[model samples]
Target chain A: MREVAALAGVSVKTVSRVVNQEAGVSSAVRERVSSAVSRLDYRPNLAASNLRRAGARTGLIGALVQDLSNSFSAGVLRALEDTARAHRTGVLATSLDEGVERERELVHDLVTRRVDGLVIMPASTRHDYLVSELRTGTPAVFVDRPPRGVDADSVVVDNASGARSGTEHLLARGHRRIAGLFHLTQIVTVQHRIDGFRSAHEAFGLVPDPRLVVTDISSAEEATRVVDRLLALDDPPTAIFAARNLLATGAVRSLAQHGLRRSVALVGFDDFPLADLLDPPLTVVRQDVARIGRTVGELIFQRIDGDTSPPRHVVIEPTLVVRGSGEIRPTA
Target chain B: MREVAALAGVSVKTVSRVVNQEAGVSSAVRERVSSAVSRLDYRPNLAASNLRRAGARTGLIGALVQDLSNSFSAGVLRALEDTARAHRTGVLATSLDEGVERERELVHDLVTRRVDGLVIMPASTRHDYLVSELRTGTPAVFVDRPPRGVDADSVVVDNASGARSGTEHLLARGHRRIAGLFHLTQIVTVQHRIDGFRSAHEAFGLVPDPRLVVTDISSAEEATRVVDRLLALDDPPTAIFAARNLLATGAVRSLAQHGLRRSVALVGFDDFPLADLLDPPLTVVRQDVARIGRTVGELIFQRIDGDTSPPRHVVIEPTLVVRGSGEIRPTA
Candidate 1:
């Protein structure tokens, strides 16, 4: 700690504050201390002490997600919470809302507050900033998306396969004008889904019309607006593939508004709670949320239990939930 | 700290461990130390130190709710998170899952970890257990329901009034036989909603059919089963009042399955995302979740800012969101 302080030109207490995740330290000082620590390969003694307390843990884990209210994130969180509770641990859950700065700040807060581990749904494009915290032996399991610029344990569904299957389903239904609705982020999962969308078209010797694919939606409300615009086009899409749950819901609304729900087919990526109860019962590429969450919980706890193994990446396959909405044949 | 250790017949480090929320202390030791703490009214010096760091405070707050996966709870959590982030505070969120023991334990964990404050949607019947934490200068504000067996700041929507309005809407729709689908728990919020259901019937000089009011539903799936049974009854209800969001969704499913959605009127208690996009567009009693969450956030932050004022209770009234489903005319 003293060496890190000297190297960073800060007091020993400042280094301790940075390492412990306490507030009051300026971002610049935190950066300097973190750089110095990384340069010196400093691992906090506290993490070493944590490894020794095999049976006893802080009884708390942090769950950082894009949005806790979203069905996909919520389902994963519930599964993790149930697993943590069985072990008498409480989750310190927070939503990042896709803000890069917010994710960094909250991660710092959760660590400073001293959680046993973390299950992160990273919003930040890169996670190398967390290298110091990870090296200090804080077990982190990324969920829904793989970690960027830093290696860690992660649990994600096969986004590409899921998207391919949904698109294939639409193609099999003989829908030629299939529109792809996707979120705006450059997130790997979203990109993979878009790739799947295009690849499905290519495999069948059909080129996807760039105009039919709408991307860069920020919210479900935005999805509705984008879907409305797509429907307004002279050559409207006969089938729609929504890459996210909220986007799917938005497509449903737009289709309903345009009186096209029964005429145009739709497929969603993630299945939500009442998707089956929708007007036409939404067809979705369902990621086994409970299993994904369980995988994440297992990996995080395994590391907490002193596992020094190399980081593991688990990708669960997505299954197609064939409900009525996606089964709608494109009308002539 | 010395006195607490002495009184509890534990070492000072054990007491420190308990106070600092560190692991390694057994539950028995924790209980004894907590008891000693309560008996001696011991306030950890850390909390005092927290007060001195007023401007540079702990950028963490605890948010305890029933289930973060539930739409209502998730919405509340999101609202609180938005507000907290605006103030540079991170939420240490958790799900209580309707377990009293779990709520107590999680609360203990959050308090001992020294969050700036808390916003709780409590599962515990009584919150007198939290008197010590509150007394120790941790600001707490309850949401969705008022604290029982204790006086504290609270922000709750008038559940009874909202439910009554929904029931009355159905009554005014010329429905004589109305079924009430309710959740099992004796949660005050649920009870208030039930009371509203009954009072609405009484106002019209009618006796509610006990057989039609099916309660004890534990899950959204259970809500489906209960609604199915209600429909199976001889002279089934002409309309249904679902006292919760999940129950409402279940009721919609049941109605859809029975091919009676257009004929049977239904009104749900709490509004959920995409409620307006349902087949007939569900009419619901809207709780103004954003307002409620914002109010809770404001109160807790005020208390954290060293407001030693008397506890305040804020009750927001709910409004009926009338859509197609709830406005259905009874099939005579």
Candidate 2:
């Protein structure tokens, strides 16, 4: 502190004020002090200071999601940020990219930085690894997926019910031959959605063709290829149920190329931007993403505010949006 | 360490290995130790430890963008994350939402947390405030925009040229009256794009009507409203040049609603996901977002690795993607 004050030609009190980000210091003086502090590589031991000040917080939260590039994850993050900012807190967000090891690593990193709380959309099947962190009083709220092996506050869309409704919509339109395009089956949400797809078919005393049910469709391009192959089959599906946004996008592309967009009925699980503006207009089972994000934010903040209540599990219901694509009747 | 070992019934060496994330510790043992550490609130002073070891890093970087929900910013963040992971680093990503004060505050927050480097798409018009941080040896790379009032590594798309090309394309299609839907003029890129729009008109000895060139459109819905109002005029535009993705989306919606989708030509500045799949397809001036991200990542990493060379400014040229929309002929 003395060195910074001396170098900046300011009083030690002024330097302290600048360093503490307190008001009443001129911009020039603050800049000078900051420059001096930087040149000397002087970092105040914030952790030590926070420890000394009772109830002092780092005012930083950690958020780990599946992918930052995906609209679903991005929307969740944005909402969390909005909530955090209201409390004068900052969020440290990172993507796990479906890597369990990466999730653990990032959780560890964030904890080391002494973040006040955590909001995680786990890539791991079991969150037994987080047991230690939770025990240490690091409040956590899971989003998009529920936590397994450890109890935690969670906000998730009713994937199975949503998928069932979308599938049932096509089935109600008299389409028995429907193709199911899905993401990785290992994901709990995906498995639930698959179950819903099966249950919807069972309601009509029918079963989905095993050949038409494709899993592990990772990218839009891959989904397009899968749909193209399905179309080439001896018995092409008359309707398609895409379990994810990218999968739906691929299906749209393939259907467009095959010139069967108007003929084949399609219902996607998740709604995306401009879904209603497409040629035939896409029908989807739309998750209330904003509400989900807001719910997760509120839950996480509540936990951080020392709520010792039992873990709350929230399931937001999705609604099926009817448009031109899903309303298409089977030509066959 | 002693208390943690005693609580977990593990040797000090075992606890050390677990804490350092070194190999050879059993999962059960590691879990026990971690739990004990959490219960005891035993935090290893990583900052002190890092200081003891030469060239030690916290293995974290900070990224601040305008909006994470926007595809452009999200895509850049994802690419940066990919590159960061290759070097076994975690990125702490945040959204500024075009708030200048928020940018300064987050930068201060990240600095206090001791991030090794920064990737910023600044919301501030001038970054003279970052001088002290730079002097303190924080490597930063500006993305999507250039740094003002301070010299730093920057990677930006050629906004003017891209906009010029798009406007010229519409002009070449014999559209004399073209409406320009733009974002906030305060943004440097927006200003550059507006200049390009004017220059394109000038090439044909024409000047755009100030009434047709609308600015300060903050949302797609707003753009739609603006386009609708413009369409109701006696001298309606035959073509539309949207300066951003969201603005273009708004124009597309309004055009569709007005039953003029095929009649009015439209070209957007930034290409978005599913642009090719839209009705009549969206023509755009596409920026190589991945490449820009990679370049920023490379430059920041190089600086972190002690590269003290003069700050490099890399401007990536945007490409005009001629699709169905931009090729539409004017009927007026």
Candidate 3:
């Protein structure tokens, strides 16, 4: 800092102000400080600067996950841990269980601890408070789903494309009556997947039959009931496409109970543990969770580094991994 | 603090000195400060005290996990996350991959971040550096396995008891020959389970028969080969105990492939997803992962509270969850 100040022909306080990006510094002084900083290869001692204030870096990055029990969330969290470790920062992980008050409390506590940044999966529809917090120079990025009612960096799966491709694969295999099972979460990601599924059905010149669609089943058990009803239909679908792993588990169980594994072709979104090891291996669209997490971590770090141009959202596409279930020729 | 000093009939500096437990303070003065603290319900804010110094709560806890992919670590990490969230603290998690340099770097990074406490599942044979760090008033506790060459609070499962119970259950079902399949982690927990299995066989006046024991198999594929070799033997064991979930997966696959699911009995140490829905439900010795995690969290928090008492070790007992697979009565 002293070398920069000397080279810039300015007082130490002026150089400090310029480096910290304080508003009072004149444009000319800022330019001089920037040039001098470049010339000296001066890297500001961030820890020292933070120590001058009560709120220090805590060297922690707060990660607010939606649910820990979900395999997707766990995988993403692990990836984030790896990224944070590389930056010499540690993660402070909290699960909100989709509660608004819990999210608020978590955010406030993390702020009080002065974490370096946050990677949050917001559950609530109203994210204006988060927007305000971001506007005040706090770096944050949303994952799994985009931030609603706010502008920020986001990392999400190309759910619509994934669903379309999955449904199209079923259609290409001569299956017209395909049931789509999904959870009732009001997140934009789920909406995109549903839209994609609809698009694929329309492309095949088929109506999006309401009877073949199931929603509002919050758990695998309820999903099992939905599957039971679908298979019990007079013209039961020749195939099923579960929109998530838990629903897929339910579908698999339903098929196994009725000994229909040899008849119905099953395709699921999101690959899960033991998916391939099943009696008739499951075919599903697998998301690159680790890559998505790593991308979000990098974006958040860039955002924190004053890379403030515009909010960016990156969507990685999912790939279909065919094992056996999806490749089954429907014997309808 | 001023009020406390007044109530204790001491100067504010004297109160501070007593609170910090500086050696210069007299016992009488310490007693007075203690009484004043109790009366005022005053909790000294370490953050405030460390304004010009280094030690402070940092409001962060570090968790060092051996392998995130392992079910045991995942369960414990989830439980620790829940407990840490309730305490309004954040947990920084990292996977060691059992690398000594990685562990050292992780420990250094966590200490540099000034985390209030640590919950570690050691990766190396010894971590004396961690011991030195803890000795400087940094609180730490071990989980799954204790740190080598140091004494500290540790929380682990009763591996021996669980293994012994499982082995005895198999013996009681009139199975004369039993095989043990273990992973290649070379961890103490694994050794304990092997010992317990041996003890059970010895109690029944049966030899362990080296041919029946298979080691150095970590993944499902490797375990499948080991199980195949055991099953191919002229005098194959009537039953097997897989030491972990992946091994259990292998055992299930091998048993199913050989059409031996109904004839051969098997019990696994850790539970896997969808174990109950297999051809025959798997029996497992289930560890209380959540309980063990909560215990470790509490121990670390207590240490962070400046409890300089002797180190304590906690062992949580495992339960035998009997299912269809282990109850297959061997026929003569």
Winning candidate number (TM-score): 2
Per-residue lDDT of model 1, residues A220-269, tens digit only: 88999998998889998999999999899988988888888888999999
What is candidate 3's CAPRI-style docking category based on DockQ? incorrect
Alpha-carbon deviation at B290 in model 1, angstroms: 1.5
TM-score per candidate, in order? Answer: 0.82, 0.89, 0.78
Tens-place lDDT per residue, model 3, B1-332, is 89899999999899888877888988988999989976775545434555546554566788889766466787788888887866767788888877778888877667655677888898776767666566545678889876678778889888899899999999989998888998664678888899889899988998788899887787888888888989999888889999888898898888878989889999999875666656567889998887887888788877877788999988888999998789888856
Mark the regions of model 1 whose C-alpha exceeds 4 Å error after superposition: A1-57, B1-58
DockQ of candidates 1 onward, in order? 0.20, 0.47, 0.13
**Local error of candidate 3 at A269, Å?**
1.5
Query: What is the C-alpha lDDT profile of model 3 across A218-280, one tens digit per residue?
Result: 677887888899999999989998998888888888888888886899899998676866767
Candidate scoring better on DockQ of 1 and 2: 2
| Model 2 alpha-carbon drift over 4 Å, by segment | A4-48, A51-56, B4-56
Tens digit of per-residue lDDT, candidate 1, span B1-332: 79999999999889878987998889999999999976775544422335444454656798998888888888888888788878877777788778889788777767656678988899877898887666546788999989987778999999888989999999998999999988865788888888899999999998899998877776777887788888888898889999989889988888888988888888998898778878789999999888888888888888888898999999999999988898888887
| TM-score of each candidate's B chain against the true B chain | 0.83, 0.89, 0.81
